[model samples]
Target: MTSRFTELSVDCHDPERLAAFWCEVFDFKVIDRSEDSVEIGSWVPTVEEVRARQMPTTLVFVQVPEGKAVKNRLHLDVSPIDASTEDEVIRLLGLGATRTDVGQGPDRSWVVMADPEGNEFCVVRSLASQD
Candidate 1:
């Protein structure tokens, strides 16, 4: 059998804040919440048993050490799910992502941006445009 990605958890100082930020970024919803964490998902899992047994698929933002350096070895590369690249960039910026310069020039392509926790991500041009 082949392995598949069930979730993408991010370590942050504030889980709720990060979760909220990602929720807006991906248009995901808070399907579950606790004192220390929240679970945001694109699909709505039915039944409590199903939700619990379904691998807890979510982008969990857990609390971490303070003064953590802004160096993420693994970051997400998000593309517009249903909107244009420009629109997606605007939405992400409004959701708290800041434009960052990772030495990539205009010729290199992709809009480089950082999350609230200083994690760098790229927003490339729409896939539809390539086709």
Candidate 2:
């Protein structure tokens, strides 16, 4: 049997702040928190929803003393569900994300950005625009 993907853990200087930033990005809610870690997750899917594969992996942020010094080796690629790509970028920017360049030149389809603590992620075309 194959194992299922359930959660993604992130190391950050401030788990609360980082978790808050990601919550807005993913439209998730903080489900759990502790002294050194925070967990944010989307709505829990029902059995039918699970059968349809509607759930997404939850994100966990843990506090680390060291700051981010190098580019992220693993990053998230997210797509807008409610707005156009450009509009989503604007919204994200308004929510404390900053546009960042990571050698993904202008011709690429994705817009690279970083969260409050400089974790890199990408904004691609909305899923609705895929057709």
Q: Highest TM-score, which number?
A: 2
- Residue 121's lDDT within candidate 2 is 95
Total backbone collisions, model 2 = 0
lDDT of 1 at 27: 77
Give Cα distance to truth, residue 85, candidate 2, Å: 0.7
Can you list the residue pairs that collide in candidate 2?
Answer: none
Cα displacement (angstroms), candidate 2, residue 120, comes to 0.4
- Model 2 earns a TM-score of 0.87
Error of 2 at 128 (Å): 3.2
Which candidate comes out best when scored by lDDT? 2
Error of 1 at 101 (Å): 1.7
All candidates' TM-scores?
0.77, 0.87
RMSD of 1: 3.9
